[model samples]
Target: MPSRTRTHNHQLSDPFAAVLQPPPDETPAALQARVEQEQEQKRVSDQIDDELRKERTERKKRSRREVKVLLLGQSESGKSTVLKNFRLKYAPMQWKAELRSWRAVIQLNLIQNVLTLLDLMQDRLAQPDGPRPGSSGGPSSYSPPSYGRTSMDSTISEITLASSRSTLNVVLTQKHRLLNMRLSPLREVETDLRRRLGAVDPEFTFANGEDGAMNGVPGERRKSAREFGVRGWIGALGFPTSGAARNSDEPMPVDKATEILATLRDEIISLWEDSEIRELLRAKCLRIEDRPGFFLSDTARIANRTYVPSDNDVVRARLRTLGVQEWRITLEHNESFGSEWVIYDVGGSRSMRHAWLPYFDAVNAIIFLAPISCFDERLAEDPSVNRLEDTLLLWKAIVSSKVLGKTTLIVFLNKCDLLKRKLQSGIQVNKHMLSFGTRENEVGVVVKYLKDKFKDILRSDASQPRTTYLYATSVTDTKATAATLNIVRDGIIREHLKHAEFV
Candidate 1:
């Protein structure tokens, strides 16, 4: 009984002895093969572990080492223009690839302007209180659209309002669907072009809303008026096999863009130059030249079958922002600063300003653009407030923000050229801004005064402890802007390096 008890105790202590037992010896060849198989398995396992560790290291480095910049400004203040300049300087290949898309946007702008003129013509004709041609009353609502021309050609002028009305009616009757109230014909083409360029319609927000809440649910994409233009052409036929492979059998995407623009060019010009249309625009004080792609002046050339948009033409094209967009590019000329830069551009409208908050934490630097030329203009979204005043208020909020204490603040006093021209044209600064106590309206004086005002605002927001670099820039001039940006890039890199040493 004592012996049996001893055996049971030993068994309890030796629970893993079976797993530890060695196998019986094998033949020499079999042992060698087994050893080889074990060695191969170990090698593959180690390789997989090494790969996983390498990927983790790369991810951590990317998160910690990337340089980020933010572009901030009000709508139409030239933020996108600055972004484009960066592309032209650093990413020429990508820039060229996207240039073809701008032709469609330019064409869309021109077509919309003509449509506005046409709508005005139709509205005037339908006005119950307005005098008809040759019908006696007080002064008629027949003021001609001012192209700065003294008169229309006698041959066209002789076509009186009544006759011109008939001519327009005949044209409209034949193209009733195209001339409909929805402007579907043009919109369909516009939608297709926008889609190819990966554009979705932007949300509308209340003009003064601080949160930038959308009229609809946030991030919900809405359909524009119509969507059946050039896309239909592609579906009914077929897309080129490849955008890079250009031949008779497979024209490039750029060629397709050229064809669309050329097809619409003459039709847009004809409507724009119509005697009645011009007169209506004049009466309404609507100047299409002030708009983007006033292609009327160069219709013959732009309409040529061979024409493609130049880089400058693409730069001049305007499209409003909808939300936040981020662009990442590798540094080519300025490799000392790190290999990559990520830039964030947000919509500058009051409502869209809310979208800027989430990015404030991670941004290394901020480029704030305030168009000094906006002193005389009003906000397009909110007419009650002067644009310059709003810009100043915005600047105060940004520089004073406790959240952005570490962010290097660069203020671009943009559109200096436009300010100079507006001042030269006798637009008095004091007249628009009563804050100026009868100061001279010269460009140099006004610019200095404006800069001081902005500086004063920055000073009042001193709790945040920041340095402000002010640059007088016209972002449209690529050479000058590029020079300024080089200085900015270098400054930012130096500051980042300094900060890194402390961390």
Candidate 2:
């Protein structure tokens, strides 16, 4: 037993002994040389270890100095728009570099508007009792579908037929058919552009009840079925990063789309501007102008070959965020507030909310955008819930989160412009929100009411006491938003410094 134990111990030590052993034929001079060589190696190893330690400490200091902001809101609530504003302000060079790429997206937006109009026109024409010229009625009684267990087709059909009884008397002639045929090539262009934009994923599939679609569908069908979103903006825009190959001469997908749009520009304008078509749109209660990424009104300018998207155009551009996007901007002029700012933009759709949990930790501040204009609107994914209701619920969940207890909460009652427009158009706020009852329907009253509601939620639901900033904003108005952002930037910096013990 003692011999066996000795053998086991010897086996373990054999490898160590081999490593410690020196050359059997070593002379004193050779031994001295080996010792010196080992000593030099040890010195190098120690130097590397010290450098690594210093690097780690520096990384920690940099992280501590970095200011992280998160943009949160429901889909189309202007989260991306706010991010663009930040980039345009603090990261102008980077924003300018990516400006040309937005041409494709703008073109795509215009094409989509055209296509939607064409589809509605075709659907109208197919009806046996289509509205005749000069037909008029009371205001549209159409209410978009509430959340119910129904197939997508049925929901779409209901929406299509909702305004059927109130449609403007517009007749489609053979000219419309000819124009649609002329624009058929646009379908191909759209498919090509979507492929180039990385909007379609072949491997992924949407299950039923996901994204509020009732039927399971392959990701390939998402081209038309789902709101457009690229997997990553860097890859989608073909923006070159470090070590990425750049092919300056390579043909871009936008070029083809642009060429096609330029040729069909007149026809598209004619289709869009036709008095009959305008009446038809009004009759069907299809407010295409209200949709995100709308560019029909700018068709002529956008379809031009030399078109460049203005700063306002980029801010208004709607690119659905699929996951979380991190944008880092080094403050060029403001050194006292920290040199580095990291902004996280997340997908706010109900289906995408799961992706947000991982980011809640370590966020310094959150800019939550609630589009007050959407009080009457329903979530596209879940039509049953009012947009305002959904926003409040989301705000409650965010404030009540224990992980985000220390984070500063900032609320931008966004899209005040749209809210004003809607109010002026005679949409009753109380009709959509019972809680908004008996209040004067003025914009100021509506905004104040909504702001107070948000404040109430923050006060009641927050896990800990914290300061909350509320601003009424029209985020699309670059000038006004810039001013608001300045105030917001200072507030964020102040909070950051306080948290960092620099105050």
Candidate 3:
């Protein structure tokens, strides 16, 4: 067998050494021509290598990620569908729950993304039982799953049954396998330093809504490390997600998620920069993945793969904090250029309005979607005021002290299709609307209006990373919509991310 060497640091096709070698000495003019030819060859090789990587990913994928994007808005704003979308993507195994309190349900389609098996875990259970703080009882009989156990999917969305709390806790964890799975998916390896350090449970609190005070636990602080479900209770611990899957003795294309994430991350940042709302940093929460590496590989290979089972230390993505409700984050990556995003979608429902605040400080960009189908009599005579009220709150928070203008805000005039439909129905708009004679024209004027205001209103001493223009976007679940998004992605986002001068 061929012995493995240190992992490749350059693009697979180019090799690090190839990048370092200088061209043969030649006349300055001839060197320029030679360089162009070299560039062309490298591009072709990149395309080929891209195809190879995609093939590898698709050959064994089984789990499709469904992100639980928490949406927040007032009573009338859309919220239910956002939660429903999450269910459609990450609905659990045998999930059975009344819609009485929850928002929506989602079950991801994996057949289309068979290469993700390496990314999926069959052992869905991730419960760790622990006695109360002062109790001396045995560790909660529950444990994060032994190495390589797998759970078969039972085709039920929910089950209302009774059982001991121990089994119930285990079952609850199993139902949310995908969510628990994303908490980094690979566990930390056992380390002496981690064991030596003492653990402390820092108080954890988050608001249920924007401007909503942190309502979790106030009177007491639980030692986070002593908790049962806590990994390395009473201390800090984590290992590489990539290292767990690859044998120290074996070789692999990428050893850490960061390299994979870095390549993917730069592309996402580029897309954000190119957005028509790139200045606004809006219209970007969309995702693209599962095509495998750079191109499509045979779907059949993805549909079939020999299963290898082992369990060592893979980080579980579950959010486990005492006195805190559990949450699932199923983060996934795709070969497509725009698959790295985890958008907190704006769903139009009353229940979802409370989820918007906590993450505002963390996101690098914010897409403030303003629907065009409003203020036509049913909404309000004062459309902008009504719209501004909700939006102003969001803007204030993102630019607030916690975020400190760290995030870029992108405003989008969403549902442009609604405008076209209105025009077709003989609804009269401004003179500019008639001049364009189509939905596209009406949107252009609206975008122009937003751009001027963005430049005018947000030009302030405190705005560190400047805010930019707004774009009119139409997001429908269709091919034309995808094409439209791709154009904005290429022409706008890509351009700005590659802006070397800014760096």
lDDT of 3 by residue, 1-503 (tens): 11123223333456766565444355678667867888999999999999989877653231121112233333222222222233233332201121111100000012112112212212212214422333331222222211111111111111111111232111222323433333232122112111333222223233354221111111001111111223331122232323222243332233232232232332223322332212111111111121111111222211122111111000101112222122343323232332333445432222333445566554444545555433131111111123323443444444443453644455555556655654455444332122223334354565555445344445532346465435565543233334443444343334334431332
Better by TM-score, candidate 2 or 1: 2
Q: Candidate 1 clashing pairs?
A: 144-279, 145-278, 145-279, 145-282, 188-229
| TM-score of every candidate relative to the true structure | 0.70, 0.81, 0.30
Candidate ranking (TM-score, best to worst): 2, 1, 3
Q: Order candidates by lDDT, high to low.
A: 2, 1, 3
Q: Candidate 1, which ten residues in sequence have the lowest lDDT sum?
A: 213-222
Candidate 2 TM-score to native: 0.81
Ranked by lDDT, the better of candidates 1 and 2 is 2
Q: Identify the leading candidate in terms of TM-score.
A: 2
* lDDT of every model, 2 decimals: 0.61, 0.74, 0.31
The TM-score that candidate 3 achieves is: 0.30
Report the lDDT tens digits of candidate 1 across residue range 193-215.
56665554434334443322111
Q: In model 1, what is the error at residue 409, expressed in angstroms?
A: 0.6
Which stretches of candidate 3 lie above 4 Å from their native place? Answer: 1-333, 336-340, 346-354, 377-385, 388-404, 423-443, 460-462, 484-503
Q: Which candidate model has the greater lDDT, 2 or 3?
A: 2
After superposition, the stretches of candidate 2 with alpha carbons farther than 4 Å from their true spots are 1-45, 134-167, 201-226, 242-254, 334-337, 501-503
Model 2: colliding residue pairs: 147-384
